[model samples]
Target: MAILDNTSLQLPKENPGAEDFLPLLGTDHVELYVGNAKQAAHYYISAWGFQPLAYAGLETGLKDKVSYVLQQDKIRLVLTSPLRSGGPINKHIDAHGDGVKAIALWVDDATKSHHETTKRGADSYLEPKTLKDKDGEVVLSGIHTYGETVHIFVERSNYNGVFLPGYISWNPHYKAPEVGLKYIDHMVGNVGWNEMDKWCRFYEKVMGFAQLISFDDKDISTEYTALMSKVMSNGNGRIKFPINEPAEGRKKSQIEEYIEFYNGAGVQHMAMATDNIIETVTALKNRGIEFLTVPASYYEDVLDRVGEIDEDLMPLKELSILIDRDDEGYLLQIFTKPILDRPTMFIEIIQRKGAKSFGKGNFKALFEAIEREQESRGTL
Candidate 1:
């Protein structure tokens, strides 16, 4: 139950003598099970500024489902939908509307990664399989994590196709301006009540991650709600997951609402990294992206708490962007309203100057903003 003040912020440390059995290169792609892949793909292309990369559907010889791949820099998103009723994709979409299904991780050897994690008590989601085409071959395997979300291990060193073996190059005439999004910074998961530590241990013992930092109800509470979080990171620092659970409070917390609507533990938000947050946020806003906003009074004393920063205070305040400083440096970030209809999944735009820590200084303002949104929806 340590409070993370600006002066006391610390980065995650690797576990002592922990062997890196599951060596992951980075995130390959994030797949979402939507209701319609074509329209969803158009939304991502027109609104989020993701470029079309590849496709696989009836034309590609698949009958049950269709997938559309989009890319922006190093970030890739795969949107899949069921072509027929009564399939798993339809069931997943029925349960959780347009949510992430697989968080694919890039690895050097998918077979070895699956063997190591499965031997460490992980539930097997997909066995080791090799997909081959004219370009090359790609090996893949998977393991179940919290809830229905699965982590797919992708080894594509031998593959040079557009995306995978079955997918073909998708070149569409419609294009949008790039938004300067670099890569996935981190993904946050919301578990049921008092289940944060269970998944934290799952990441530590099963996937070889170490505790980064922790925040309790005392550290992350408002007048009406509270939540606790513990961050876990891989040995190479390429992946980070912060597990959150609801704490006792005066009313419903955001984590509780997410769990109730999502029907189980799932990813709450994905934080995307940008080198120029001001420009990126501006483009996003121009494209009709709505963000959560705090009161003007919150900015009055923000500089006094965070000290001087490189960016001008007026622009950050104008866009309602939040700023926080760790021992290393400061970071600029902002959260979008739930993109989906269920108030479940959202996106975070962040730019790191040198800071490695999450925005502990801006928790109160951010949560208060979230509470305002919840109240409007009558869920708070």
Candidate 2:
């Protein structure tokens, strides 16, 4: 039996002390630091179905950094590269590969969000600054999080600019069809030893977040590795973050392996929501994205545990997308291998078809699958 926490998905109820979060303002945008912005943008548009939305580079007068913006549904991603070498952007890429650098939070007031988080001890990355152009003015502020990652507060109430002032409206000849991905579900981070609770408290006290769920090292441990995680949620449940910390194991846990390769703490996985995961995963696989595979025997008794799924059982087996259901509804979810060389970043496809729970039932299978990767990489 799983050591289900009190805060695990349990019907219409929510975790205590978790304030009523207003429906998330939706994803403001996800900014990533990469080695090459142009190539990264192509990967997203040509392969991942994101349409080019904005652009800023040497041509845009930014001599130090270049950024490419892409969007699909409510999510936007800004891929940035250092125009000149040896800057902080280069350092970030050197450390974490092409990983998430900032998760910009959409808010009604950028200044207020900055004051609130900074007063609560968030180190200021960008002072509340307003940028204006012919289109309009946008106010943005930011604070540092674990590793080189950051959370930028975007106040766009008075802005009509394409993106920010520096970026201009980008019109690309290529625009891929929407992949059915709607919004961000949750972002997972991997920290060094015993640091999970530290960041958990940072969110609780600094950002008005609350612990939604937790798993001990034992619950998430493989035979040769162990890690601990705690889920934190914003008021509206729109933003959820799962923080992971490595623990002593016979060999090395995935978290430790990431820290070793990435050189520090950073994002581990980003879960994006979709209404039709079966179709989405099918599309993703056909587009050349690789997903983990599990043993055939694992599927033999799945129904005996989670009951029936609307999808054809054979397709689920064929594609390797895992399905699980709770009292509320069933959700389809699948994880991808590390997108970059360091093994610090990956993507998750999630579809909530009524069930409100994270796929707790898939934990054993998922970890086993991850361990197989670890074995190949010689980390475990």
Candidate 3:
């Protein structure tokens, strides 16, 4: 379990001259189109420790759809479902099951963000629109990204509502305890073959992101499967998106399986940050969240490669968490089995000691673990 040489880990130097025209404040909220918003919201609340925040439906004057907003610290998730038999929300759910629809970004000016991105050749998903309530007013704009997913620019400086203009405060009596899950660390999207560079370029030229790191098939492959990835980050380093595409593998790679089941390129998983992964994961497991597990051999020499850390090795190894290190520091991460029925989307729980890089050193062990799951599903 020797770690790869530091030279093999590719962390590209940031371009000093790179200008960020469309600056983002942070992730506003992730909206998912699900078959049943009520049940989906309950799952997130009970299993993932998200508390109820707001709601929108007929009671809120929304005729065509309903939405339930949940929150945990800085992370917000909006679960939406269609009210009618046929519409865009229903269509999206039919095609992709329960998956992320919008990666909403907080910004200062929604109009300016839309103009900047559209002028740079990004497809418009939502024209700049202003919504108002007694609380205040908020501006929103959006642009299409890889697959059917979209990036929504939300300008809420003028608003003081619970969630948004249309949504009312949803004070649910059953509140789950917080799991210490903080803000979103990053979101990874899986694209089609030969499409990784295209989306990466879109993030670079349109969104003004810089390449933080890159992984070829050689860096992230097992004997049976392979994939390529490149991480893109915003100017302030608050947002990160790592795009992955399947490579030629002996069998089906996870990216290929995701693209196939999701019906196209889409968000694969979201990595959520935590101050104490041990406590958070323990709570999540007790609440019925299952994580992928690597063999016992993975931990036999993990400390040898990752070197010294503040936390004890026994707990991390017992929980099947993977560790990796870079020049900055080391990070602990573990992946969940696909949460949806299609085996398309999942979640990653990550705790960074100081490391800025993804776990390149854990690639083999992680992918082998994924391959094991694929074998069980007969998709490998």
lDDT of 2 by residue, 1-380 (tens): 01112121323424457643222344588899999999989888866788788898888888899899888777788999998879899988877788889999887777888888899899999999999988888888999999888999887767666678888888978776767878889889888888899999988888878887788866777677777888998766768899999877788778888888888998898899988888888888777788888888878988888787787888888878888888888888999887777666889999888876778788778888888998998886
Which residue pairs of candidate 3 clash?
none
lDDT of 3 by residue, 1-380 (tens): 11111121222334433456777767889999999999999999999999899999999889999999998988999999999999999899999999999999988889999999999999999999999999999899999999999999998888877888989989888978989998899999999999999999999999888888899999999889999999998877778999999999899999999988999999999999999999999999999999999889998888899899999988888889999999999999999999999999999999999999999999999999999999999999
Candidate 3: Cα lDDT at 370: 93
Q: Give the poorly placed runs of model 2, Cα more than 4 Å off.
A: 1-16, 19-24
Candidate 2 whole-model C-alpha lDDT, 0 to 1: 0.81
Per-model TM against the reference: 0.95, 0.93, 0.96
lDDT of 1 at 97: 86
Span of 10 residues, lowest total lDDT, candidate 3: 1-10
Each candidate: what lDDT? 0.90, 0.81, 0.90
Candidate 1 vs 2: which has more TM-score: 1
Candidate with top lDDT is 3
